[model samples]
Target: MKAIWGQKMAKVPISWMVLLFMCFWAYMADAEYVKYKDSKQPLNVRIKDLMSQMTLEEKIGQMVQIDRQFASAKVMKKYFIGSIFSGGGSAPAQRASAETWINMVNDFQKGSLSTRLGIPMIYGIDAVHGHNTVYKATIFPHYVGLGATRDPTLVKRIGAATALEVRATGISYVFAPCIAVCRDPRWGRCYESYSEDPKIVQAMTEIISGLQEKKSQLVLNTMWAMVEQPKVSMRTTR
Candidate 1:
């Protein structure tokens, strides 16, 4: 009698069982939100709730940022990736439009939203000079050229323009307004610095205010301002 009963149960079709399981899971997900998922809760309460629920693997995944070219929705969904970036060489497919970029971001976002905690991913790119990488973006003068102008107001306006162009392409973060003070003209990357004089670099920081119209991001280098001394004394008995 037991053998006959097992045979009958097995004949019920596996697809039907899978369909029922999926439906039950969907219903449960839609039925309620824990405190962390509730928008009305205080931020601290939500943070504590979310942190308590995160597993070690999930926390690690959140701290890692995969390059966009190497990532896809399946990877994001599986790993719960928290961030992605497009480097200087990475670009969308040929002749890709603003819509294409938006769609790409949205697809990755959907993957993240489907995770257990539904954390969104931050997308980034280098925006040193007016969204330089995006197709047809307005390219502004580099820091060296801008420095020569000696007009903080002009640099500020450039920063504002850069922010708008970057946002239009669905990117929020910018690596811009390099604040390094370069004293030597021969340094290969001195162009990134605004000026050799500390005062000039200080004044040009007005760009920060303009970029802050949306949100200005800065790169902080723990470098000290020092002058190289002359190897030989210049004194000859006067």
Candidate 2:
């Protein structure tokens, strides 16, 4: 009888261990880390309040945008990169799908959010011409052709559609509006520019209108002024 009682007592620790683990798991599951502030709060005041909570390193980190290939999630976590972009010709991984892109980007964002500041990381892509750069994405005509259509309204409409598709891929920022006077026909990317005229470039900035702004406020890193083409390409065209 004593031996049987000892055996039953041995089972008590195992049962208690299982119960304790379940309770801890339930506590973690119920944990809520996010909270919403009052809409009545001034935008800048809210931003300042949040910014003050962050360290100097985190602030400086927000200023840098690196290619995802170069900056791994671990490195981004260490450096606190404010943004990561998959430049044209960069893919998430082999056999990547739209869902794959979302998973990859969201994973990086999760790492960023895990930081002390909990600032969500922004992902950018060159969605120029209907996200043409991404595989299986709906490709739209370039600005030059769209400019010939002479429909600023249509152009804006396309931009709105592009924004929807781009956002669907779990990326909010787009590097578009390639505003350059491509006078030389030989230029490879001349198609990206609307026209040789600055007026056309000025008109097309209305793509800003097409992109859904959050409550009239442009989200972070909306514009990245790309400089002139590569020197090697320039020499090749010349």
Candidate 3:
């Protein structure tokens, strides 16, 4: 009886030793890989750590921005797409509701997050005039019209409202505030421009302050300010 009891006691330690080894291995593995997921770390540190882990393919995917109509969640997951955009007139449905847009974007976002590194995707839309692509969204005046108002304060309010309407659709970026100095009335995109005068275009940039929010920090870095010259040449006064 004593010999049998001693044998059983010997097996107990071996089982416990195996369990301890597994626990230690798991902790070490998690410590090695999860540093980037730690929110307590500085943003630069976290970014560096994550970048260090990414492969060249992953890095390239981070640079490519695809239109939503051409890409799906599966494609985003496979390629690890960094950004998705809805070009003018592109919506999940014809005049999709805000809720429908949110659902569509969220689905794509989930795919991006499911990659090996789990990086979130940034969604962009041509919300130039108050989420115009979405049904029931407030359609603010065009930049040309807003420029006539000469009310930077009112333009700022419009920007703020546009931001909210955009957020309701789960988009984080906008292609707006076209600061183009329309040199000719013949230009097709003139309505998108704030004014032909450089001064008014510069002044309307204040709208950015209102578009960005404290909590969400929607990126306002994608403004399109192009310079177009008409066919007619102007003579310079010497």
Candidate 4:
């Protein structure tokens, strides 16, 4: 008579099963967070989430921006470039219209979005003198002419106008409000600078504030400033 096989089983520890389930649940929770985070969240929170997903090479790559025409899509995929720039006179082949510029930038942005973190790329241009180099864009008076008018409010209005035209072309960052204390006119970009006096240059911060919307990380650099105001007290010390 063949004896009945009571039970054929492999034993698994209860603690081990519980640990495996916990790990799976935790992984699911993390995946959900990564999928849902986006720009709509608070700026700090969004940035922090993106930071957690980036590698060291990716963070280093973000600091170096390259011209759009020169950027390699393969390298962009590998390096995780955070920003792209179109300095004066750079444009895609076949079409150089404003709409073409927008489309080209959007294409690059799409490639950037394909990376693991899905962060959007920031596009920049020298929108100095009313997006001057691009065809069909407005040509405003250079800083000198505006300064000659000595109307700060008018300057602000011009900045706002420039900002609108720049946005129309689908660009978010502008290398504008060239603030320089020009001691010599021989400099090639002196024309871009507003004044020879430091204070006058300082005043052009208003123009920068106008050109860029509030609370943006879009400022570019050429100079540094140091403010040292001596405090005077007329009241007698007690």
Work out the TM-score per prediction.
0.73, 0.68, 0.80, 0.71
**Candidate 3 Cα outliers beyond 4 Å, as residue runs:** 1-29, 215-217, 224-238
lDDT of 1: 0.74
Among these predictions, the greatest TM-score belongs to: 3
lDDT of 1 by residue, 159-224 (tens): 788777767767665555566678777867787777898778777777766665745442211122
**Residue 152 error for model 3, in Å?**
0.5
Which of 1 and 3 is the better model by lDDT? Answer: 3
Tell me the tens digit of each residue's lDDT in model 2 across 1-238: 9999999888787778899999999888667422323357787776877777778899999888888887666767888889887777788776578898888887888788777766778887887788766777778898788767766777777778777778777777777656566788897877877777766655665665676555321232232123232211111111
Q: TM-score of predicted model 1?
A: 0.73
lDDT of 1 at 14: 96
Q: How many clashes does the backbone of model 3 have?
A: 0
Off by over 4 Å in 1: 1-31, 184-187, 214-238
RMSD of 4: 9.2
Q: What are the root-mean-square deviations of the candidates from the true structure over C-alphas?
A: 12.1, 9.8, 7.1, 9.2
Full-model lDDT, candidate 4: 0.66
Error of 4 at 149 (Å): 1.9
Q: Please write out the lDDT profile of model 3 over residues 69-130, one tens digit for every residue.
A: 97788988999899988887888998677788889998998899899999999998888878
Following a full C-alpha superposition, what root-mean-square deviation does model 3 have from the true structure? 7.1
Task: Rank all candidate structures by their TM-score, best first, as comma-separated numbers.
Answer: 3, 1, 4, 2
Question: lDDT of each model, Cα atoms only?
Answer: 0.74, 0.70, 0.79, 0.66
